[model samples]
Target chain A: MSNSTAFSRARFAALIACFAATSPALAQPSTVGFDQISAGDTAWMLSSTALVLLMTIPGLALFYAGMVRKKNVLGTALQSFAITALITVLWVVVGYSLAFTPGSAFIGSLDRFLLEGMVYLKSSSQLSVSHIAPTIPESVFVMFQLTFAIITPALITGAFAERMRFGSMMVFMALWSLLVYVPVAHWVWEPGGWLAAMGALDFAGGTVVHINAGAAGLVCAWMLGPRSNFGKDAFLPYNLALTLTGASLLWVGWFGFNAGSAVAADGRAGMAMLVTQVAAATAALVWMAVEWLTRSRVTLLGACSGAVAGLVAITPASGFVNVVGALSIGLAAGLFCFWGATGLKRLLRADDSLDVFGIHGIGGLVGAILTGVFADKAIGGVDSHLGVQALGAFATLIYSGVVSFLILLLIRSTMGLRVTPDQERGGVDLALHSEQII
Target chain B: MVHDDKFPIAAQLFIRLKRSPGRVIDVTWMLENELYALEVLKVARGADAESAELAARYETLLRNRKPGATAAPQQPTAFARTSSFMAEPEPVPAEVGRHYVGSLR
Candidate 1:
């Protein structure tokens, strides 16, 4: 290894050591004498888990597949499905521990690696650990949240689709999940997390998931550069029908994603679901109306995209905002995201292939800001933690952007980010798998 | 919310109205302008007026010859044109535009 490589490795090792040292010294809590769980909560969680999984497998996969050039459709879908499998396994092995174990403000140590002490069925409350859905078992909760973790990085892949090598992407994702996503998740969601301590109220990962993914996606697209025919060619989706269906699935699945964050069959979950639906509906209408006025054609693709943008915008604030707040947020997200995807992106000339930064980044930013404005104490039942929410959002945006850029640089230096021109022309499926449609 | 199938129709209508070959039309203006026009039309006629009134108003606007008034309907600008012969079955080059992908087959 070079001197810099050796130094980086040494520094990483030392940081891991420091993390280990600072972990709480408490022994694993015994799982004896816990009361039986409610069937309604159990059913809700199970269905929510399925919905979240659907968001990745068919929902996100198809959405991205339809957006890419026809030659790369199967490749894009395969990557999304593979991420679902990979993240599930990783969550079971160490991802859960890194994100949820009782530790410092930044990240959790490996005390629960491979799910050591979580084999026994017990609620998070009974374990008397950090507060994160005390009603659900830690393992169940990890599995549910793993679906979110899986999709967030997969979403970024859309930004660099048709150009990235499969091997390089896999390596980047593995490292990114470990170094970036887990730490951010811990910071926002874990009971003793620094952001949580500072009173940041992220009901469903506005900062940790959407903003983090969006900023990182922007960096990845910048580092990877535009595709071969980016500016010169008129690149368009091959299948608007597929895109619409995927967007519909995402709209439905998001209710589970946002509401299930509450971890109980409660009124808050109902309100979150309601707001999610209203926002999606409003956003779809707004986007269609805008497109009809501007382009004189209300394409299905625009409406689907608008619905998703609204869904993303409402994720963080779904649990906090009332119906009126949801409507305003949704309408704003639809209009602003449409502008970002078309006007701003065209101005910047960055090939964020499928508008990841526009829809998710801009949408997430809008949600974070609106959360500050509409966080009613009577609705969400939490004090207006607007300042802390702003701080968390700003911190996540800066950290994820800089670190994601550095990681992309490191990966690019080690193993090139893009495929050869011939490989890209031939298609990633053929290039990576040595198979074509025939 | 309208489904995706309605998008093309809505967009076509929007483009038709925007570039209606009328005087000084720029389709690239924001949606707010379209809403403003709709509001103005609604106020000019009654809100309960049918589609005939709207069509009459559109025709009048298109044919008006006052100084600085909108011009008569003319051939579409290059940008307003779609690839020709898209609904046709053949792969003929001239039938479609020069850049049309049908020629590739």
Candidate 2:
């Protein structure tokens, strides 16, 4: 038997080999075979994929549905569901290849086009695994990342909720997913990504998901313009109960989102789960307190939004931060997101209908920057620079914003981005989808 | 409060009425009397040439409303008659202004 010191040296050598194997090439099929894949990690990843997917379908769907007027509830909810279907198909086709496979630092190669090289040959007992996650089957890793892809663009639908044409929305999201979402996912998550090379520490997509979606959401809000009589109308939500339920679902599903980023069922993943809970709970309480202090009453919406804000803010830091870091991040997320949704919303005057930019955008920024400040190297096994984090966050924001604007502009000039005023007056459910709550 | 089915029109009228410089308009009444509400909305939205005068006339009638008054003889209310600012016959009658105020509790 080997001595303890020799065992340690061997483990270090194995770690180096694993790191070397992950170095970006064409994601070079797989030297890691089926037997090598960890069953535990694969099981967790499969469950996490399902959990993350849940965050989009009924979770985001109901969250958005409850916020819209009675006439628009169906249309609003449909956006999330539709994006889920759309991105699922798109991710399988070319999106996965262009995002994950290594090529240029700016974008990925198409070696895995149509998931071509990904194989599961039971006869030979050989299966493919992604270089990024050699411990799990590539199929599970692909599915896990696909959930992230689905939710990112779906998040933007909240900004232009009551106004967009369904066909135009579908078109815009498809294009935005390809043009804006794909490259940014490559830039941040893919090992060959420019941001990754710059030592940006995004444990779970602070820049890639939240900032990217937030910027696109802001642009959508601006381009779609405000809902009719936006500033002057009450715009009461259809049902707070549904919103609360959806928020609860989101809160539960976020464990998969943050913890699953660890790609392993280890101590790190456990720490991520703990911090996520701490941050979300802290932020929820802080938001209600602020609302109670300022408005003399706490609102369910404020609490839910605060919880989501905390979740968003802590996402990038979840794999990197400790409990104290989570508390600070949660506190800042609550206070800043409240102001973002109210004061900054009024100041921006973009009519981001559902406060997407206010909460997700501002929350993402706070989280991304704070990750640099609070990242514990002991936990993450990496140190992060504040300037590098800001660079990654801002770069994603600008890239997503500009590309989204161009895509909207193109769609607008061709098919028109909004329904006519008459159609809008009739409610999108009846006018757009020919369905209503009755 | 407006019914869900009629909320779209009610919301439009509410916004238009709120923006127009005047006393608070009874959105519930306007929703109940939708056709006349559209006319009021057109004036409130400044779509009419004499919107200012029309709005003032409407506000005066709304202000003088007497709740719980049964329908009376077809007597012209103060706002129904024309003044220097008006040419067309206004729709305001005493009964039109007398909308019910339901219990809040």
**Whose TM-score is greatest here?**
2
Native contact fraction per model? 0.00, 0.00
Each candidate's root-mean-square deviation in Å? 17.8, 12.5
**Candidate 1 pairs with clashing backbones:** A296-B11, A296-B12, A296-B15, A297-B11, A298-B7, A298-B11, A299-B7, A300-B4
> What would the per-residue lDDT of candidate 2 be over residues B1-105, giving only the tens digit for each residue?
544444454444454544544323445445445344545655564743444445555445444556763322352332342122133222334432221011000
Chain A TM-scores, candidates in order: 0.91, 0.94
Clashing pairs in 2: none
Predictions' DockQ, in order: 0.01, 0.03
Q: For model 1, what is the error of residue A72's alpha carbon versus the real structure, in angstroms, after optimal superposition?
A: 0.6
List model 1 lDDT by residue over A104-170, tens digit each: 8688878778878764533543432224655555556777889889988888888888899888888
Sliding window of 10 residues with minimal summed lDDT for model 1 chain A: A25-34
Q: Mind sharing the TM-score for model 2?
A: 0.78
Model 2 regions lying over 4 Å from their true place: A1-31, B1-105
CA deviation > 4 Å runs, candidate 1: A1-36, A121-130, B1-105
